[model samples]
Target: MGVIPALVILYFTIKGYEDYFKDKKIFLSFVAGLLAGFFSVLFESFVRNAGVVSLIVLIPFFEQIVKTSILNSRLARGTEGAPIYGATLGLGFGSIFIPFSMVIYASRWSGLDIVGLSIVTLGAIGFIFFHGATGIYIGYGVKSDRVW
Candidate 1:
């Protein structure tokens, strides 16, 4: 369900910055982000017993960390394109996050109507941006030699 929107956003966003990257670095970073997203989902599954607070806290913490792992890629080395690549990676992570969370919370799933659905959509968008912004921050940090 969420995959289409995620990919749509990812495609438009990355396409705009494609000129900044060389070879397949941008694509590689996105793939790495997808891997990070899958890894986070699998990792989260094994730790679901930690309770709700952890779901709101620890899981996201770990995820942001993992999503940023793309920053370590050879394609992400240059400062000029780091943030763009980072955002791509982050959006890629967002691509999997919705399906991942839907599965994790399936037992508790409930349909929401207009208002509730709107809120959920907004929240998802915000979180996707959260991933992108954090990626940008870390990527920028690396570019600035802060050693992200």
Candidate 2:
């Protein structure tokens, strides 16, 4: 459920800028997003363990920086498709991040039936769009030589 929406957004985003990215760069950006998602989990765990009361406030800052780190690298900087690449990267990040989070929630909630799972999936889809939209903005910023 989560995967389908993410793929749809990815397909359309890439389709809109189909000529901008080669297969290799797209793949690399997606992989970077996945890595960012993984690291976010680790960082969140560390923060939780450290008893950080301001974690909720800090998450957005932490996530945006970590998630877009790859886009700020030299390879991405050289590309004319920075916006497309950033959106693609965010697609990858949200694809992994949302589903992993939903699964963890489902696991913890013993009474989560199909209805509950469906709700979570729906929420995940919303989040997928949010991530993709933010990525587009980030990419646009990069392309315009503006810091975000």
Give the alpha carbon lDDT tens digit for every residue of 31-59 in model 1: 78778877887888877688998889989
Cα RMSD, model 1: 3.1
Off by over 4 Å in 1: 11-18, 110-122
Per-model lDDT: 0.70, 0.73
What is the C-alpha local distance difference test score of candidate 2?
0.73
Model 1's lDDT to the true fold? 0.70
Query: Please, what are the lDDT tens digits per residue for candidate 2 over residues 45-108?
Result: 6675555554766766787887567777864675678888888788777777666666677788
Highest lDDT model number = 2
Q: Give the TM-score of candidate 2.
A: 0.83
Provide the lDDT at 38 for model 1: 79
What is the RMSD, in Å, between candidate 2 and the native fold over all Cα?
2.4
